[model samples]
Target: MTGTASVADMDQLGADVARPTLRGLGARWRQRRTAAAQLRHLTTYAGRPLVALTTTVHLLAGAAPVVFMIGTGAALQHLDDGGAMPWLALAIGAFLGQQLLAPVQLVLSKAVARRVDAACLTRFTAFALQRAELATLERPEVADRLAQADEAFEQWTLTPGAAVEGGLALVARYTQLVGAVVVLGVVAGPWVALAGAVVALVARAGQTEAFFRWGQLIRGFQPLRRRATYVRELATSTRAAKEIRTLGLVDWLDERYAAENRAVLDPLWRWRRRVYGVPFLTYAAVALAGSVAGLVAMARSAEAGQVGAAAVAVQGLVLCARFGVMFPESDVKLVYGRSAWEALLEFEAQAQHDAGPQAAPTEGRITPAQAITAREVRFGYRPDRPVLDGLDLDLPVGTSTALVGVNGAGKTTLVKLLTGLYRPDGGTVAVDGVDLRDLDAHAWQRAFAITFQDYLRYEMPLRENVAMGAIEHRDDDDGIAAEVRRVGLGDLLDGLPLGLDTPLTRALPGGRDLSGGQWQRLALARSLFAVRHGASVLVLDEPTAQLDARGEAEFYDQFLDLTRGVTSLVISHRFSSVRRADRIVVLDGGRVTESGSHDELVDLGGTYARMFEVQARRFGGTDGSSTGAGDDEMRTVQA
Candidate 1:
């Protein structure tokens, strides 16, 4: 029973083996199809003239060696006949042409490669921006694909340019191989040519299969590579420099980078050893045996006068040339380049899925006539942890509402949901009774002007930085200037060498970096510029955190005038700032725990009142008229 299987069992075992083989063949066919499509795509970017020229050079270069061998062999035959100058000249011309073509091919390939790379990078950037929500970008799988697509130029990786170039070279290699086989067949016999062809192809196929397996293995390590790269970046980042030096974390960071890299490489090394060892020896042995047998057969034929001197010479050269086609560099480039292309395709598919269906133009640009409301909204970054459960809130048109909460109370999360940056896990955020999901995401986001705690400090001209808020109206120079003054950045702008034209970061020539308070004001100007260009809703989250007490007070004094006709939501820890809003809402346990005017909430003596008292006591007074005390001292005084 152990030694002999029934017919049904045999059939099942055969089916299993055949299934995997068929699947492998299907995968290879798909890979080849993808490679062909990518080649055509790359050539389109490289332009027809350049591609044509490069291809012609590669083919001629590949055929040059075969021509040289035939010419030399003919020259040797003519020497016996005492007239060899023409044949010798032909041989010399072919050799020199091969040498000269090398540099020409290199230059052309580089040019084509650069153009293809630029086009691919541009497409990648466009794809990244296609997604309407931020949640998809944060997914681990998407991030891994992004990293893989981006890091195609590493030594271990292959760029699209390299892949296309390798593909061309592979075609040339086969040309050379076929030319050698044909010459051998004519000079010797069909059997010798067939044997040589078989040996070369089998060896090349085995080597190619090994490289393809290696590529597949490395693809699984993309996440590991991403983690390692992130660790490396953290160790070198300017933002983290101060903390790293203070904490003496250089060695710790180095260890972490090494650990992450090892996690990727150890398995790779083990796989290579197991996969490459025996197969490599077998290929080498086959190549060696085939070469010796073919050479010996030609030598015997020549000695017996079965073939002429020219035929003998041609056979010898062709035998050697056939093995040269088995060079592994082109194969490696093709495999790695194909892998990079596949990564890009994978990312594109995910991005399209994340973007979902596109809404019609008219239906997309919805504006709330009465209110934006959240009803029973539930959300969390992780499934097990719920951040906002059954949260309900309303922002009435043309009114200022302040949102107050302790840390981790989902104030920021709520703002994100309202702005369509993220969707709730359950329930709906509606604009004047219309669910946000039914609206065009871009148009919905464009309706609000927001300033967050961690606003981006763009290292560009100050004019461009402010104009980024509403790019279509960047030419409205007067409006830009007015908003600058409104945000209290007029003096800073006047002091600049080029005024609004001056670059924001010191990294550029003659550029200046602003202090934290000035940058905060600049961020405010950017958001206000959006309002000036027709953004109907204004959202400010810790907008004045970097400002001093006087600056904060000045901002609050102008707040009502700034947001007079816009629906506004301001999130701040300061009771003074919250008091400036028409309505104050306290967020606790993912719900609106308190909703009233600041004075009303303070009078009610609930969570908002207790928090306001604690903050006010710690600061001595909200108006900065009294000396502030430390946390422990405030607690002791209260006790």
Candidate 2:
């Protein structure tokens, strides 16, 4: 009874082990099928003719080895029979064909890879730009996925294009292996062929699994890799070069880079060591044993006169070919490339989820007729730390409003909400009486031309830089030139050798870099150009921050003219620059604390009044007597 119980227990354990093993195999099979389907889809991007040509080349190349082996065996048989030289000639031709087809296959494969890569890049860019809000791009998880997708363009990294090409090549290799196995079975015996094929397949499976695991490991470390990459960029990039050197941080950056790199690579290195240790040796031993067994079987058959010398030779070649195709380079490319492709798909899924349901397009453009108003608006970058809490404000049409606040007072956050880049967490932003959510986001955004505090300085031609504000009107050279002059860039334009055609960066030949003041003027000109092209609302956030005192004063002098017939919102710390605004709103503690013209606010002696008094004292202006009161208010606010 004890022995019977033991036998039953052993049987149950065997069943339990077999269950998961079978399930794992099933899962792997499904994954392979999915990979093959993806490969086929990507290949279509290469165009039918190129794909067809590439396929033909790969197949012919795969068959060359089989033809060579057969021809050599036949030639040996003919020689033994004292027959003609035709078989020998065929053998030579096959060998030459094999050699010649290799480079052609490589060239064709790369061509297909490049075409597929270009199509994938375009698709990626389109997907990234599809969302109307900036929230999706700002998420940490989405940023990590973006880094993974970006790997496709980096050197030595796997891409979807490479995966498709590798999949095709892998198929060709298996075709060759299948042909060799069949030829071996016919010439030698079924048992011998089966033994060799089993050994080769087992070894290949083990290696492929190792690589697949490595690919997954690499993918899991993408965030760490991005961190490491960022550190490396800080050490190497031109943007950080001056700061890094000036701060004497070279050694510190180097150490940081090393630490970040180790954090990413140490686990991968350990994995590689384990995989390449016992497992790799075991596979090598299995392959060697299979090769020896096959050779011995073929020799014994020859000795027994069961097969001729040619048959023995053919069987020997088949064994070598079978093992040769195992542990292929194509497996590495396919596995790693598939990981990158999967990352892109995963990003798309996550981004779609983050985007929620798409809003149906509202017909016609929604322009502000009377006012752009925020009613009890609330927003926060993080859930627990609200930036704008129940803030209410309004910008009437054809008037200028200046927003003033301390550093963390949510001035920029309010602008983002009003411009529809971010939706309020609560309440609503409205155009006239219409809620912003009801309006088409793109059309609403088009109604306003904004220049942010940190505006982009594109390194394109001068014309292209300004025309970026309204690209459809890029060819309107007269309008572009007029806007340039209107923004006080006439002298800069005249100094340029190519006028509007001069490139903005000195990195190019005949290109020139601008002074900070000139770049500010150019940025303003871009926004003004947008206004000329039908944008009726203008938003300027510290637009003159880069300009000198004279430049700032000049900008203020033209402020009314620059914003003529358009509703404008200006955000600035320079109270003097915005004193003439039709209205001034002071933001504090995530809410509007004061609203009036500059003189009215000063007379009220609130947060805005105290802030203006402090600035006036610092600049040796008139309001010296109120300095002590202003300082007391600022200290209280800071606390």
Candidate 3:
């Protein structure tokens, strides 16, 4: 079950089929416990005063129904006597109390709900960010759980006022039922009361189970909805608009979007219909039968003089109210809320388990002043497909080394391991002879400045984007501007309206977008800024992929000049850019196949020389244009 292999296995079976296995009473108990924990956690944020006020108000309001019923019955009975006005007053007072308290409770409940939601969201997001391991975040199961928890929270926490009121009503309804049955047990008979109570409880249990089952289906359905949303966005968003039109794929994309929507919603509809069919019908049948029988028994008692007309009316009222508490809106709300709470707890547990060792390093944080070495490193994103196997590499201090490899040769994986973003499954990544696992993670990260091929576009102010590399320099405009100039963005900045303050995306007012090459330059500037901030190691994974050959060569020349004494690892497809490195290592099948200077590798005439020759011939044509024969050769070599 390590890595993504289990995720693939689960995906093949479908998330719906591989749903959580907890069942029956155990599942119900777990859900209840989760809900209780959520409520308890919310109080930490919502404040005790608000919770107390809301509970008291809702409880009073909820109990009003039963009180009003009894008051009305008593007042009606007292009509022939002189005591009617006082009884009437009692009923009116109770009614007014509910009315007066409702708006206040609702307002307080809403306020508390918002605070609780903010607290939960902030804590959950922080927990996800602060965890030391990236593997948990990379897991599909963990991701889905997070999404489900968020959805659940949003759906339920928004209507705190309603939830409070509904919960109180449920309690009040059950209390009234018990009281009614007790009265019947005395007047009608214990046997009749026992039968009615049994039927009512059975119906309630069935309805609860139905809602729980529906929640499970909805959780499983979330992935499908996400897929549908992605497809729809691709069909409609401006990013994909050009491709859709140029490729004549507008109709095709629309069809795909429609298919995705159907794929998500069709099963949902079926599940909903099925859920509302037999299980709900059974509840309805039991409820109807119990209500009718209870009413009939009450009427017979009145007719037989076993009870008064007021008593009979009270019994009937309680019977009707028993079914009233089975309101679908409230039940569904609780189900969604509880399900979310359960998911949140589940994810927290999983993340806690995945967290790295908590013990402080005995040797404290060690800076990598000498070199970083991976000895017999092993890693895999899946159980069966090892991405890096027995990888042994060294990033020597104070030198530039170029890593060249074909696709799937573990070049990027090595960079990740070296940077300590991922720990190898076996063996060791050591910095200055100290294992990475023993060093302080934050200090270890500060040792390297890395830029991956798929770098982020922050869509923030241009200054913040570069300054993010070193937060202490975030407000240092002069220093940021200096880095910008160094990266050759001075002319570009001069053209912008707000200069460094301007946002990178056109989505914001007064913002402007940069060309891909410009962004790549900005990324390099950020990395250089990190080095300026005392980072000892600089790693770039396909940093010049967006640049032309000339641009890439220029970047490499500048890179070497800027990082003259810093330990640097550069991965590039261009041989010209990589050949300038002090040392070049050719990786093939997760192992270093050749290690030497470019001339030495070429002289060896191994895989590196073959690749170099292929790329070299692409530029070595007769008329400054690559020949078709060379293209064929490249394709043949690559294949």
Candidate 4:
């Protein structure tokens, strides 16, 4: 009725009433297969003995319903004889057995499901974290799929135990139907049981189709759900709480949330209209009429002395059990369970593909000894807009080098490349003339201790916070305390309630949050802690930006002492702060425009000299002596 098939359309449609329905069935089957495989895999984590125990108990529970029906029929038959009290007792016992088993089955099902969930979540989360490239984690598409996969096991009704219960229910119901048919054939005829089974199957198919449609609607709502959640978080989040109130955007966000709700619900309403307006009502009417007709036919046969009261009773019970073979909740679970597995597998494959190839080092790995050199290295987030084009640089062993660049001049990108978070698109970054790609990335990374401009504040104990940088020394309280003292946090330790063991954030009970400057100092301590753990190179990317002028000067002096013989590359835009480096390189438009010590650069009177002069003047140093203006004057006089 939905589509009038012409000859050509019939060819396309084949024999199915709805092509989409057939496709849905196929997809559902595939998903079920995937879910079954995953469930089997989950059993490994759930322990085989527990699974077997639960499964055995569940099978016994499944037979209880059929046993109750058969026992009741026998009791009804013996009631006419007036002496078979044991049959009545058997019937009552079977009924009580079903009731008793329900709670035990429910508890066992939940226990199995929870164990499976824990195991699956752990495996999938580990899979997500194992991507070799950082870029794969940043993709929004990948994030969306990952979120869906993560949500799969959270729904109780969609759990593995529930899915198994659904299958067992089918088997139980069909078993009852068989017993009913044999009983009916002895009393009335086989036609009555046959008619009932046909009607029940048809009715079940209709009900399942409706639920499958509902499942599809739910799937479509996922994006809207994500959007609504994001908007709601913005409305209620601490980070946006002040701005939301100040900007008076409460009503606006409320309207947007409502709009998202409507977007999700409107199409669902239309679908409901189609489902209930005619087709569902017709299905209900036909099923009800057919079932009533069958019962009436059995009653008439009894009146005519062709069937006994037991036959009529058994036929009714069998009809009820047949309808229980499939249910809306079970169908929904089947559909969504499949969806979750599909999303997880798809996301894992995509993440691996997007990570590209990270081959293990083919050549023997060696630590950088002489110098780390970037020779014509190139890269960019976008293919068309290259960030580091033919960039060349060098940092010799045990010498401090400062790299100064304007914003987006590839300083952070270069740091990522050096740390092997990204691979260069052209030429090579080499350590002592060995191509970096040929060296083990992990081995190479151990040579440098880095602190970026944006550092994390781990909401953990102060000791663990600092010790995370060198995890081997995590239990070494003395080493952690020494590093904290070296970073100027020794004074604050005396005031802290738990000293090094104090939690770093108020999120935990009795925890304390640190000031911005305190966190920065802790970050420095972390880097220095790594230094104690055998890291020979230090890379600081504006790590002291949060510190005041006095603090900056004091920390830098301490830094210079700690890294006196360590190969270090300091990235900063504050010209005065980096003047103490053994050599300074100025980058402009993705290339090294100038390179020298402070005096040589001033004598050269190149880009570095101009930058220093402007910065010095801003700081009220008109004489510019601090910026090597004396070098320029002395060179001029010599000429």
The numbered model that scores best in TM-score is 2
lDDT of 3 by residue, 218-319 (tens): 666666655665677677777878788999998887888888777666666666666656767777787777766766665566333422343645453457
Q: What's the TM-score of every candidate structure? A: 0.87, 0.89, 0.84, 0.82
Q: Please identify which of the two predictions, 1 or 3, would achieve the higher TM-score against the true structure.
A: 1
Sort the candidates on TM-score, descending order: 2, 1, 3, 4
Give stretches of model 3 more than 4 Å off: 1-49, 80-83, 153-200, 302-329, 354-366, 621-639
Give residue 422's lDDT in candidate 2 (0 to 100): 84
Off by over 4 Å in 1: 1-53, 153-157, 302-329, 361-366, 472-478, 622-639
Tally clashes: model 1.
Answer: 0
TM-score, predicted candidate 4 vs. hidden true structure = 0.82
Q: Rank the candidates by lDDT, best first.
A: 1, 2, 3, 4
Model 3: lDDT equals 0.70
For model 2, residues 125-167, the per-residue Cα lDDT tens digits are: 7778766257777776677777878876675347888887787
Candidate 1 global CA lDDT score: 0.77
Candidate 2 vs. true structure, TM-score: 0.89
Which residue pairs in candidate 2 collide? Answer: none
Better of 3 and 4 by lDDT: 3
Residue range with the least summed lDDT across 10 consecutive positions in model 3: 622-631
lDDT of each: 0.77, 0.76, 0.70, 0.69
Give the clash total for candidate 2.
0
Q: By how many angstroms RMSD does model 3 differ from the true structure?
A: 5.0
